[model samples]
Target: MTQAATSDTNVLDLSTCDSEPIRTPGSIQPHGFALSLAEDLTVLQASENLAQHIGSAAAGAVGLPLARVIGDTAAALVVTELAATRVLERPLYLGTVCISETCYFDVLAHRYDGVLMLEFESVERRASADFRNLYPLVGEFLLKLNNTVSTDAMSALAADEIRAVTGYGRVMVYHFDHDGHGHVIAESLADGYHSYLGQRFPASDIPRQARELYTLNRIRLIHDANYTPARLVPAINPVTGAPNDLSFAALRSVSPIHLQYMRNMKTLASMSVSLIVKGKLWGLISCHNETPSPVAFERRTACEQLGQILALSIESREDASELQFRLDLRRIMVSMLGGLTQGADFIDNMTSVFPALLTFARASGVAIVVDDRLLTYGDTPSDEQIRELVGWLSIRAHGDVFHTDQLAAGYPGGADITRNASGILALPISRIHKHYLIWFRPEVIHTIDWAGNPHAKEGAGPLDQLTPRTSFSSWRETITGTSIPWHKGELELALEFRTALLGIALERAEQMAELAEELGRANKELEAFSYSVSHDLRAPLRHIVGFSDLLLESASNEDLEKRHRFLKNIKESARLAGKLVDDLLSFSQMGRAALRPSTISMNDLVHGCIEKLAGDTHGRDLRWEVEDLPEVRADASFIQLAVYNLLSNAVKFTSQKESAIIRIRAERHPHENVFHIEDNGAGFNMDYVHKLFGVFQRLHRMEDFQGTGIGLANVRRIVERHGGKAWASSVAGQGATFSFSIPKELPV
Candidate 1:
């Protein structure tokens, strides 16, 4: 046998296919009855051969009077023989039946007044071990076949495998249009055979009656189309009064006309496996054989297995498509969430990241819907258009995906209006009530090589429609699943993200408003504090100066001792009180001043302080030990004040000493700048060092070391304002080191 054989040669058999376990014909006689499903599962066609074998009188006479023809006596024997499996019904059954020439027929009995052929083929009495192991294996296989990435690929692959398995010359994947017509979407043909890859067939060929019967059972085989029996119709129908139609129950047959049509196409013995979906016939597996041959019971059984695999694969593919869709949406949502920044700039940049989303919700053009009315369209519609659309959508907007194949008569329920709207996708898009997003597609007279003509589809009267939708009467019904649908979750999520941006913007604006208010309050308080210092505290200091001066003036030169003592005490007390007031002012000012930091040389500042003090003091030998003070970034005036105060205090405290030692030095450390003013003079106890930098907190009495006590506190405030620290280490009567820090770095 050639690896690849032509359709004109000997018939190529797949009975020994290496890809699958081989199955042969059954032990029972090959001769059997025929049942072709059709006409709402009720119409059963029984052949004359079948009628006679079942002990019926005639062909057409048996169908209309089935209970009478397949009599209770024969029926009882048949039912009793195959009673373990199925339940006889008004036209529905669950299991198979066996009918051989020897045993009295029990399983298949027909009751009809309809348009299809219904029969129960023989049930396998002795189940094989190979068949027993198939349940779980096939279940798992079906489960996996449904999970393939591309449903189209799975469909094609299944068609190829099924053709090989069933010995069919050509196996095709057929997709049924809404009008019940079918198109061959994919096909696997024998070498040299012309393929029907994209052929279209009308619903009239299959008829409404033929498609309805596919659901009762799935596999159909017309082994010999030219010779099979025609169904027996007792009176043709209820109107035809007399013995009429043929009985085809026993013999497998096809119509002469259909046979001629097949012969014209150069094919024979066509068999199809129904592809049922969501309780409707979506399509079928159509197979054709060029040669006259019988697809025996064993081959039919094998084909059944392959058909099951195809069903499982299609279902799995559909499920995967849905799952992938959800995952993609979830990922997009997460990305949109992450794009939220402090401002809309983050979101703006993210638009390019997902350029396709805005169009996910595209329109032929968009129209805004308000109050169940059209407000504006792709570029804002006129008042007339809005009113018209609103009226149309108002009638259908209670959570339904609406479409209009023909709007030549305008919207439904409102007469006297005419317009051609080839398609409409109106989704109520609004966070609030009475607003919507409507999309419109006008009849563009585009070419559609479909039912009516293989040319442009032009707009016409109300009856004109497209493929799968023959006329306006069945337009909506046929296009039930065709639309750019709005998912509830997706719409809600988009709204939520848009709202979240506005929320962030609002929060930032609120923060700015609050900061302005606080700034205004701070300005008013500083003004009040400055006023109090200038007015209330200054008056008392002025009085002290005047009275002390008068005391000095009134005393004569001879009373020098008493006058000197009184004036000294007055000046000292007044000076201290004045200093106290000044310190208070400085403390208050520190809080208001913004820190202006800069690099300053401490050695220069120290020298300057010493020069000013030296101008006031007479010559007294004092060695100044000033180290190489490094530069520090700090407020210049503040650092000067701190150094001056420390140096001045040291000068005063050492006035009584014979030789004063005052030192200004800086030590470099890894993290901070440290400056120390060490003086050998009066120093306080280590325990009193804690009070060194506090306001008006002095460890030494005025009689020993004089100070306003605010100097160290001022130094602490200044250093801290520059984000540094100030502290003093002192020992009683030995020495004191007043150390402060200037931080090394700046804040953001």
Candidate 2:
């Protein structure tokens, strides 16, 4: 079934309605004889000229067993092979059969619509086993094809080979474009013959149905363009009372319109072999002769095999080229990713990275719109024009990627931009913000030479038959407002690049959030520390000052024991103030430290931390349980510091317990690894968990825990810096489990 006719102006005006029905023509070329049989092998019909060879009246042959019409021996042979004839429209050669004592004919059989049709043609005298000589020639032809690296080279070589082998007056390799229109890419002609090379033919010249038949039947041969079509006896089959479908018949008659087309070209004989690639019609190996030149069956078979070999070579070469192209693009993309990491901000460094991106899509210019910042590189449109184009794309673009060669056709006021960037391949990184990465292609003006005037009309025939263009003169057309169209590979690369760019944008956003949080916390900590220093330090200083002043005044009068007590109180207050300052300095250093990430074993890091904190755990009845932990990519010093803080807190808070229990293990999540340290210690209230990881925020009294409330805060900062998070869960009296998660796979 065919689709409904489209009203697109560019569509070919092929006379679809008036075209002859070539498939079910109910006729055969006079060069061969045809006969039809019923399910029981009874002759139901025969060609009008059957009696000339078989000495039997065509009418009298009907209703007779095929054995009586031909011969018992020949009929038995045909029946034996009929059972294996499964493919419709594919004829099976049944060898030669003697029609009479003086004549022998080559027999071909095919089955259609439950009826068997057989064709017989006179066997021409030829050199015995002539096909055997074509094997080496075909081998050489294939070798030549294999050595050719490009499609055009292969096409040229094929045309030359076919012309040499078939001895035809002209042979051309006609290639079909994305549209059904064809052009002779390569041609070889005999002396005094005009060339059709580089000439474009409209799609209507071949019609849709004709192209379909080409795929079904790989080779079509018209021995003589002007030969009369032989009428089948009864015209329509007796059993079905309809025209015979001569689609697969070797001697099928040509359509009248097509014959007229051949006459218009002034060609006497023609042959076409389908050049199929990847199971679709790629083009045709068209052979035309200035005179009636019938190619022998053996030579035609060789030509068919050659076309098949060429198709395989074409597919292989194209695949290899595409693979190499993708590899090159991937290499360029990798370089672009490396460049993305050169600067701290992705958007700020867009101009520096723009050149690599433009090279990726082979575009003349590029425009990157990340949020409000728009950056242009190379020969780009004006700032106003770019903004306008981006605004248009914001509303009209579909999916994550949008591309067009004729940009002006889609966007109003885009023609000005098209002067430099006629084509645009745009990828939106953020839909909400309308962040985009666009590559631009400049206009490429060229001329197309049609075989005949496309707009001219010669005359109309009966039934409003669409007449073929009468003139063979070249008609040139200059095209504008377009750029070289983007290739499929380029589009695929753009999509891949889009994914990478989006990832970078997301990482940048995350880094910005982390910075903002760090800055905000620093400001709050500065304010809190200012107040704490004034209040907490003043109280300690007051005690030291009051004790020292009292001791100094009464040094001469006070007893030795009272003086010693005063001095001791002063020393204790000074030590407390000094310790607070040291803790504050350590907390500040944790925020300023640079991260050096490497693959380190958590088990080893935890053990090292425990060894360092041995003094705190000495002489205590502590039961330490450490499970096997996986290795992770992180800064060794930072992770160690976090572990040390958690472990020390567990030992300090559990000092009152007769026996303390601590456990360390790691749990795996889909995207991250979570490590936990649990202790059966003085757990804090769940209500105060929100303040647990804050700077200088303590859940327990300072006298009870002996901490500056900086341990958990440092752990949180370290985890956050490594693209992870930290939290704790506990009951009031049970144990607290402190856990931090790190991403399993780090991004590039």
The CA lDDT of each predicted structure is: 0.56, 0.81
Question: Best by lDDT, which number?
Answer: 2
lDDT string for model 1 (473-592, tens) is 111112221323345445554555446545654665687788787577456545644554564345446656766776768666577776777677667667766776777778778868
TM-score (all chains, Cα) for each model: 0.42, 0.84
- Backbone collision tally, model 1: 33
Estimate the TM-score for candidate 2.
0.84
Q: Which ten residues in a row have the lowest lDDT in candidate 1?
A: 20-29
> Which portions of model 1 show Cα errors greater than 4 Å?
1-55, 58-77, 86-153, 164-166, 175-185, 191-193, 198-268, 276-282, 290-302, 344-748
lDDT of 2 by residue, 1-748 (tens): 1113355423224446335576877677766678888889888888877777677877888889998988887777677767766635577676666656656666777777457888887666522225686789778988788677788888888888888778898898888987788988888889987788998887777877788888888888887889777677777777677888777788788776666567777888889999999888999999988887776666777888888888888899889999999999899988888888789878776667777877888899988876668888988898778887888889988897999999889889777777778999999888787688888899988888887866674565432235555666788989898998888998888888889888887888899999998789888888768876887667679999999999989879749899999989999899988877887877787768887889999888888888887888899999889999988998888888888988888888889888999999998778889998999888989998999998778888776776666678888988887889999999988879999998877544
Which candidate gets the maximum TM-score versus the true structure?
A: 2
